[model samples]
Target: MSTEPTASGHEAASPAVDPPAWLQRIKSNYCRVCGSPLKLLKPDGEREWRHVCGSCGYVDYHNPKLVVGCIVEHEGKILLCRRAIEPCRGLWTLPAGFMELNESTAAGAARETWEEANAAVKVLAPYAHWDIPVIGQAYILFRAALAPPYTFSSGSESLEVALFAPESIPFDQLAFSSVSITLRLYLEDLRAGTFRLHHGVIDKRPGSQPNDPGAFVVRDHMALELGGASATAAGPGVQEQ
Candidate 1:
């Protein structure tokens, strides 16, 4: 199919038929310690194959990344950012980013909100943990609220920033499945007057390529629809959020 830019000034969403190279965790092809070519080998007593340097016996285990984000609320509206970057530019998403060194996950979430939405939020609690094995990313989200005056604007990574009422959420335009899952459950809880920790997995459909339709299967734990982790599961040390 032909492609065109959307009203948001980003390219139309296209099927990721070809495996999205950006999603895959890069495995080392060579050993950094000995500068030797590495081979994928299963160690005698291990359950997984890793890049091993035959010369020095050094091994590199490729690990998934930790992504931190928040569900920020102001009044009865939820905050969202329209991404101005790749992977899913023009798509709407909650403010989030990769966890950085020396920062608690909750702190990371707060930083991301400030960086992407220019809003200071007080993170309240752990919300959900979802593992996207297909993309080698584990998302940890928190519940948060606008700090003080609750002012916000678009950050460098976003084209636009706005608060969305539950019924006005652009579900079809969300950048990631994790965002969809979190928002869906958040809305359900909003109506039900109860909230709890949620755990889920985003699995790749068997025999499907990245760009194939229905390539990923999202599991939702609650009555309606939708959906990994580590780092301060929140409290006093989370003072920054």
Candidate 2:
């Protein structure tokens, strides 16, 4: 049997449920380091409250896991990969995966590019940080220059890899809203010779509510606004939406 992952990493479709508790909960659980019920404090200009470990003074913020990928350019074509596993199996997308612990985000992006497309890339500039709705996943995009023409790796998570021009991008086959929106903005910037990298959030979770507790939404975009000298060689620390 052909093993192909469905969209967004899972084979089955996810229900349009409420946003994740990870971001919605105003209070976090008791801290493991300190055997005490953590204190909740909503930081200024942010959504969810932060959990402060009273005994240890460990402030646990509601930060989502980050995954980074490269939008690689080679011979006037952009590299694309077909996800072999879920949440978006068989869909076309750029090479991307989660950020591993103890590694820099830039390194993680480069690694995912190599693993997914079998392409070596040099990170050029930062792209956008996207928060996938409902799924509670965050992605960081990077502008990269492909080392050469790439072939698909026979991995457990990819079917094939190919390249396409900007006008020929497969919108319907993209993995998620982030991928689609990033491509659109990138293409526009590429044509206009203006690189206006945006710092915002895109909520794709299900349900619609202002403060109904379960309604999906993204907030506190100041994290992404860290630009200029404040942005380190490691790039901005944009938590997933």
Best by lDDT: 1
lDDT of 2 by residue, 154-174 (tens): 445679888788789888788
Give the backbone clash total of model 1: 4
Tell me the deviation in Å of residue 149 in model 2.
7.5
After best superposition, candidate 2 residue 22: deviation in angstroms?
6.0
TM-score of each model, paired residue for residue: 0.76, 0.62
Q: Runs in model 1 with CA error above 4 Å?
A: 1-27, 206-215, 220-241
Per-residue lDDT of model 1, residues 1-241, tens digit only: 2335575444333233432343224557778998988876567876445678989999886779999998887777889999999878899999999999999999999999999999999988778898887667899998888897789999999999999888999987888778887888777766655565777787766445433445666664433222112222122122233
Clashing residue pairs in candidate 1, if any?
16-211, 17-211, 129-228, 130-228
**Which regions in candidate 2 have their CA more than 4 angstroms from the true location?**
1-62, 132-134, 148-154, 207-241
